[model samples]
Target: MTPEEITRTSTTYNLQSWSKQKGLNPIPVKGGEGIYFWDHSGKKYADMSSQLVNLNLGHGNRAIIDAIKDQAEKYCYISPSYGSEPRAELAKMLVELMPDNIGKVFFTNAGADANENAIKMARMYTGRYKVFSRYRSYHGSTFGAGNLTGEPRRYPLEPGIPGFVKFFDPYIYREPIEFASEEAASAYYVAKLREQVCYEGSDKVAAIVMETITGSNGIIIPPKGYLEGVRKICDDYGIMMICDEVMAGFGRTGKMFGFQNWNIKPDLVSFAKGVTCGYVQLGGVAVSKKIAAFFDDNVLSCGLTYSGHPLACAAGIACVKYYTEHKVLDNVNKVGKTLGEILEAMKKKHECVGDVRYIGLFAAVELVKNRKTKEPLVPYGKDPDGVMKGLVGKLAQKGFMTYSHENMILVAPPLIITEEQLREEMKKLDEVLGEVKA
Candidate 1:
């Protein structure tokens, strides 16, 4: 089909997510390679946000495509009850990549279901009802995962599930208090969390779910000792610590998992996105040894029709192999350093940039109308004027593609992106930010 036909068909017959349909002009992407994808009109775009930060291996990876083909030829559909080689191999690779405490894996179709199963397992194992997540988080949009979510997107699920609780992130830049050090800030947030847990009844809390690096919602890195403090709290209350690594796993954070940066072990780790790098949909919950052993006698109550699907598992195996063989993490650390430096310079050079937060290629630039007062370019969840939308559109016009949340712009390119490519794409961002009227 032509570009116009594709757009017309999609707009007429399909409903897009998180947008008003009438004026939607969806890109008719024909093909992509490396960090760039082109529309049917042959206009190429640098995937600065890695297409929702999932396409970490980037577009058109031959290994992933060939793996999918190879798996399809062998036989694709199989019941979850039967063991498959690709499934077993991928599961083994995942467990090995995870921390020492993690011992088993349960696969799912995507991140949302991965989180849903994680919550179920937490509740089943702890025999507790309440789960705590931060207010700035975006877990997923499924009914259960939506309840796990804490942002405005979850509002439609209001009067939500009975036991999900919300808390604030230790966003030091936005915090009113001026702490002397990161450790001090960590202490304050941890103390408040502990008190909140007490009020919520510690024994009744099943898990403390957190996005290890708080992706999309500002990339809010935790202060020093914050994660350790949360680990201690979970230990004290016998509450499971669940890290939602959906967007932060698979070398996105310069480590295998985001929690590894802080050297903390979560009882349950939910992951997706980067594992198969969007070549095929896949996600899983990696459980600690204790949680795994508990099901030895007790029933494990989670199930999915596509659970451990052989084709996705095959893609996952190849993806995992590509990560190591291509030294993806090393590239992330190297290019990510240059990304950080460039963003810091952009923050200094652009009056509209209030703060820049980054770790490994994952980052966000918070836009502010007034740097001194720190007034956001658009209010939280209230960009009624389409200010951010316009800004993102401007970047897109320059062939730099990314997305914005509230007043922050995401800058996560694919993991396979080189330093030169990063600098080139980021220059578009620099030029766009320079045009902002702030």
Candidate 2:
């Protein structure tokens, strides 16, 4: 089919997620290379958000592609019960990369399923029902995972399943009151969370699941000692600390995992995205030694038919190897510093740019109408004016592909992106920000 035909067929026959059907226009992507993808018309767009922040190794990684092909030739699909070399090998590699506390892996198709299974394990292990997540979080779209999600996207999924509760995120930039320091803000927020947990009856709460460093909702990195506080709270109450590393895992934050930045070990870690670097669909829940020990005797009670598909596992193994051999994490740190410098310059130059939050390549630029009031360029969950949308449209027209949530522009390029490529792409971003009126 022609590019136009393909676009028409997709919009007409397929249902697009989280979008209105009317006037939906999507670019007909032809092909991609490292950090960039081309449309049918040959317009190349830099993938700054890494196409939903999953394509960590970037497009067209030869190693991962070859691994997928090799696995498919050997065995396309295998029962999760069967012992597949790729599956077993990948699982063992994950265990080694993760903290010593995490002992086992339960593979799933993607992040949503990983979270779904994690919730199930937490509840079964603790014999409790309630699960706590932050209001600014996005877990997944599936029913169980959707309920665990705390964002407005969960609105349509309501009245959601029972036993899921929401709490405030430590969005320091948007804090109502001035904090003496980030530590004070962290202490205050943790205290409030502890109070809420108590009010809900701590014994009944199974887990407190969180995106280690908030992803799409804005890269709201937890204050120093904040995650440690949560860990302590979970430890004191026997509540499982579930870190949802769906978007933040696999060297996104210059670390192997987001929670690694903090001195804490979650009881369970739900990961996806970078596991296979979007080469193949794969995600899994990593259990702490304690939880793995409990499951040795107890029934785990959760699974998917294609839990650990050979192709996905092979892709994952290759991706991990590529990340290690290419020194991808080091690049994330090196290039990430340049990214921060560029973003800081944009903030200094643009009136619309309010706050910049970044770690490694994971970053967000919060837009504002008035810097003094900190009034967002687009209000929370209400974008009637289309101001931010118009700005993003400008960026796309210039071949810079990124996304905005509320008033924040996410700036997560593939881990393999070079300093030169980042600067060029971010220059386009700077031009787009200039289009925004203060």
Candidate 3:
């Protein structure tokens, strides 16, 4: 199709074709494979956002396509309440891949529902009403999950479901305890969290939820021992630990889950995005056996119609098989090292870059108006309607795609992206950053 045809279709059906922005639009993708897509205009753009940070396996994997087709032909849309072969098999495999004591899976068609369900599970397990999440974190967009979110994106969703409380993030660059030792910073934040819990009445707190590495929030990698400290606090307070691994799981972090980097285990790990590598829609809550057993004796009171859809199960099974056989996790680790070095070099060259953080294949560059003062390039989402909106466009015009949110740029390409490809993309990004100003 021509650009005019694509634009016409977009205009007729998608009134807000670009995520609620007045003039924003998207390229009409004809097809995708590996890490790039060709638009209706016959222009190719690297899918740097992984199409909402899914597509961990890239696109057009024959194995996933075949599995999806085969499953649809055999059986499709069997109610999730009924257990089918694919669903049962997928559950078994998921448990095997997860950490010890996490043996139950609750499926969903998307990330928001997964988190919402996970939150419900946490509350049910603890029989407490309050949840604690961070200011820089995003759980999901649904009312329940949005309330659990920390950023301004959740503002519209408020007054959010009651009992969810927010806290400051452990951003070392814009550190709350600046000039302090890393160990001291961790201890201080832990103490502050403890105080917050007490202020809220720890007994009334159901869970302490967090994005393992705070995705879409500048990739804030907390100081070491931070998660372990949280774990200990939860253990002491009898609060359930819920980690939203929606954007940080399934080989995206080289390990199976982002929390694994700290070697800390959460009571519930809500996941989506990379599970089926965006081959088919799938998301779910991976619960500890203790929490799973709670529902065994009592009603869980949470489920969705399309939970564990057969096609999604088939796709998930195939996706995991591909990751194991092709060693995608290993590739992420290998390429992650290279990407890490490149990003550090970028920070050195670009003073506007306040911080660089990465884990496995996931990475982000935080932009600042003044590096010494650590002032954000602009307030989040209040872009002031100028070249700020074109930062991403500038990268795109240079034949690369990157995701910009707030004042940070997500450099997360597909896990399958190579060092050479990353270098090329980074070069384009550097050129664009040089031209951008606060």
Candidate 4:
């Protein structure tokens, strides 16, 4: 179909997530290669958001493509009851990649299901009813995972499943109370969290779920010692620690996993996006050896028909090998530093840039109406002024594709992005933000 036909058919018959259907002008992407994708009109744009921050290896990776093809030719569908070479190989690879304590894997189609299963596993393993997650998080959109989410997206799914509790994130930049240092800020937040845990009854808590280095609702990196404090709290309360690494995993955060940035080990880890670099749908929860052993005697009580599908697993295995063989993590660390430097410079140059938080290739630039008051350019969940919307539109017009959430702009290109391409695309971002008024 032609680009116009595609757009018309989609707009008429399809419903979009997080947006009104009327007047929506969705981009008709025909093909993509590396860090660039072109529309049907042949207009090219750099994929700064990594197409929802999932395409870590970038578009059209031959290794992953060949793996999928090879798997399909051999055999595609197999029930979860049966053993499959690709599934076993991918699971083994994941166990090796994850923390030493996390020795088993349970596959799912994507992050939402991974999170849902993770929650279930936590509740069952601990025999506790409540779970805690931060206020500025997006776990997934499924029933259980959506309720675990702490942002406005959860509002529409209101009066959701019971036993999900909310907690405040340690956003130092926007902290209401002043602290002399990050250490102090970390202490304060951790102390308050401990109190909340006490009030909520520690023995009744199942787990503490968090996006290690929060994604989507601003890349709010936790303060130093903050994650360690939470880990200690979980240990003290016999509560499981769960890290949702869907967006921050697979070299997006310089490290292979976001939690690796700190000295801690979560009992359960939920990951999806970069497992196959969005080549095919594959996500899973990695459980500690202790939890895995519990299932050896008792039933897991969770299953998916598509769990560990051969094609997806084959793609995952290939993606993991590619990352290791090509040293993609090294590239992320090297180029990520340069990207951070460029963004830091932009923060100094642009008045609209209230704050810039970045680690590796994952980043967000917060826009503000006033730096003095730190007023957000677009208030949370309400961009009625359209300032942030217009800014993103201008960037797209300039052939630099990115997306904004609330008052922040995300700049997470593929992990394969080079220093030269990084500088070029970021220059475009700086130019676009430089044009915006304070």
Best by lDDT: 1
Residues 19-119, candidate 4, lDDT per residue (tens digit)? 97889989988999999999988999999999989999999999999999999999999999999999999999999998899989999999999999998
Rate residue 256 of model 4 by lDDT: 91
**lDDT agreement with native, every candidate:** 0.94, 0.93, 0.85, 0.93
lDDT of 2: 0.93
Off by over 4 Å in 1: none
User: Which digits, one per residue and each the tens of the lDDT, describe model 2 over residues 61-91?
Assistant: 9999999998889989989988899999999
Tens-digit lDDT track for model 1 on 212-314?
Answer: 9999899999999999999999999999999999999999999979999986899999999999999889999999999999999999999999999999999
TM-score of each: 0.99, 0.99, 0.96, 0.99
Better lDDT candidate (1, 4): 1
**Residue 314 alpha-carbon offset, candidate 2, angstroms:** 0.3
What are the clashing pairs of model 2? none
For model 3, state the Cα shift of residue 87 in Å: 1.1
Candidate 4: the clashing residue pairs are none
Report residue 260 deviation for candidate 3 (angstroms): 0.6
Give candidate 4 misplaced runs (Cα > 4 Å): none
